[model samples]
Target: MDVDVLIVGAGPTGLALGIDLARRGVDALVVERGETLAPGSRGKGLQPRTLEVYEDLGVLDEILAAGGAYPVGMIWTDGEQVGRHAMFDPAEDGEEGSRFTGPWMVPQWRNQEILLARLRELGGTVAFGREVVRIGQNAEGVTAHFASGAPVRARYAVAADGGRSAVRRALGIPMAGETLDPDRALVADVRIPELERTWWHVFPPSGPDSGFLALCPLAGTDQFQLVARLSAGAEPDLSPEGVRKLVAERTHLAPEAVTELLWASDFRPRAALADRLREGRVFLAGDAAHVHSPAGGQGLNTSVQDAYNLGWKLGAVLGGRAPEALLDTYEEERRPVAEHVLGLSTAILRAEARRGAATRQLGLNYRHSSLSEETRRDPGPLSAGDRVPDLTVDGVRLFDRLKGPDWTLLTLDSGVFLVRPDGYVGWAGDTEDGLGTYRARVGLG
Candidate 1:
């Protein structure tokens, strides 16, 4: 085998998975079709739960430095300030136990750069310009044939490519979903010197035929992300002058006020989920498994968490610490999560729900999974399948103890809990009654 795991794509999901696997000493490679890393501020919001995952991956400090809090929304009408709108609900007081209370604003491009750098720091490799055209799997391993290079064989393969995944299509996996919006939306990063950096400037449409425009100042960078909805069936002009014209027509800024057009793309929002996340030795992750509307900022966070969930399992199996069957739980645990988050994204896009705790994804759990075992007759608020909140016991941070790639045996006032490497509780009981059985089942024995 060329490598233990072949990750197809170098976006957040693939790079993050590479980092996790590299840290565990798993021989893995991340291959990207693009010559360089992706260059856009696409998924800009990082949820609190993702922050915790970053903390464990040893990149939280860099991520925190490269981003800032989301700015308040400022409404403008007729080129005049009208009102102020908060982008997200205030963080609840009870969430203080967790380090991050709300979402942090880091452009997706910058986020990937950080992940790639960290992956390389751990001696991981990413081969660019290697696009997988076909993937074949057998009982021994999987082989991926690229568009322009030699085929790569590995014990397992993961498809972290975008919603239109070639690996998934090659495997004949169907992506079932619906278009969330008929009107196409334009998203770009531009330098607008006249715009103030303090607020996310919003412009309401003047006429019924027009659509709203918003300019959000990207944290840690001088550029602002521009988003504008176009009329249905209209093609978005992604050129510089065209973007300037759209800005002038939609807001008070003139065509030339947009000094630099960094990157731009247009998309019709949609929600989709793959019929299955795993096909033999190949596993689907991130957008390959599910696609969500860019609402409630769930798509990117959910994708990264998908990597976090699968990383440890792959490591355990590859390191000879767990059986190959452990990989089955990856789809079992993450598909339901992708399904639930897809609904949340659609609800937020339609204004049916507000961005709050649900969007944060801190409450996500896996209680129904076969891995969760609760021997206690009366489990307290915390249970086997729930995320363990960061706590300070005896002046030591719980997250500090759970930072590495190992299971943690934590004892709290309620009971004794066995935490999985992914930070979820795998077993809980008044004592260590059923812990041995659970550990043996998961391959900790």
Candidate 2:
């Protein structure tokens, strides 16, 4: 095999998977169709759970240095300061024993750059301008035919290619979901002159045809992410003049306050989940597997988690530590999560759901997963398939111990617990009766 795995696309999802695999000593290659990292602040808000994942991946320091907390939103009406609104239900200090209080505000471009640096630091490879146009897989492995380069053969392939996934289509995998919002949203990044960077400015819909417009100052950068909801049949003008005019007419800001239009695009919000996440030797991840409305900022976080969940399993099977069947758990565990998150983000997009507890994503768990086995008679606050919350045992943080690519065994008064490489409690029991069996089943032995 040319490599253990071939990852298509180099966004946060693909780069994150590459980092996870590289740290596990798994030979993997990440290929991006674009010449460089994605531009703009597409997925700027990083959920707290994703921050925990980044801490484990050894890039948390950089991420923290480059980002800040979400600022309170300032609402304006008729050029008057109406009120300040909270973006999310405030996550209290030490919520669930995590160090991060809430979501961090970092531009998606900056986040991808940090992940790429970490991937390279771990000796991973990323080949740019190699877009996979066709793919063919057999019993042994999969071969990806790129736009120009020779075919790449690997034991397995992953699709992180985004909503319009060429790999998923080539493999005949179907994504089925409804459009959450039919209105076209114009998203752009621009520098505003003398605008307060401490608050996310909001302007509510004024008339029957008008819609909401929000400009959030992207933390750690001078740019602000402008989100304008247009009418159902209205086409978004992405040019400089169009953006400036929209801002001046929609809000109190003068046209000249908008200094630069770095990048701009328009898309209708929709939610979709692949009919199946896996097809033979190829697996779908990130936008390739599911798409969500950006209302709750769940899309990017969920996508990163898809990588985190699959990385260790792939390494185990490929490293000869576990049987190939262990890989099946990827679909079983993530598909349900994807479905739930799709519903969640859509609900928030439609205003049917509040952007508080559910949007935080801390409540998500996989207790029903087949891979999760709770052998203990009665568990305490934690259980099999629950995320292992942070704890300071003997002054060593739980996350510090859980870092790297290995399962951790934590023995407490409750019993002995086996934590999966992805930080979930895989097995819990009063003793080690089924520990050996569990290890053998997952190829950990």
lDDT of candidates 1 onward, in order: 0.93, 0.91
Instruction: State each candidate's clash count.
Output: 0, 2
The C-alpha local distance difference test score for the whole of candidate 2 amounts to 0.91
Pairs with backbone N, CA or C atoms under 3 Å apart (clashes), candidate 1: none
Which one is best on lDDT?
A: 1
In the range 39-100, model 1's lDDT, one tens digit per residue, is: 99999999999999999998999999999999999999988999999879867655645877
Clash count for candidate 2 is: 2
Q: Which residue pairs collide in model 2, if any?
A: 321-443, 322-443
Model 1 alpha-carbon miss at residue 228, Å? 0.8
Span of 10 residues, lowest total lDDT, candidate 2: 93-102
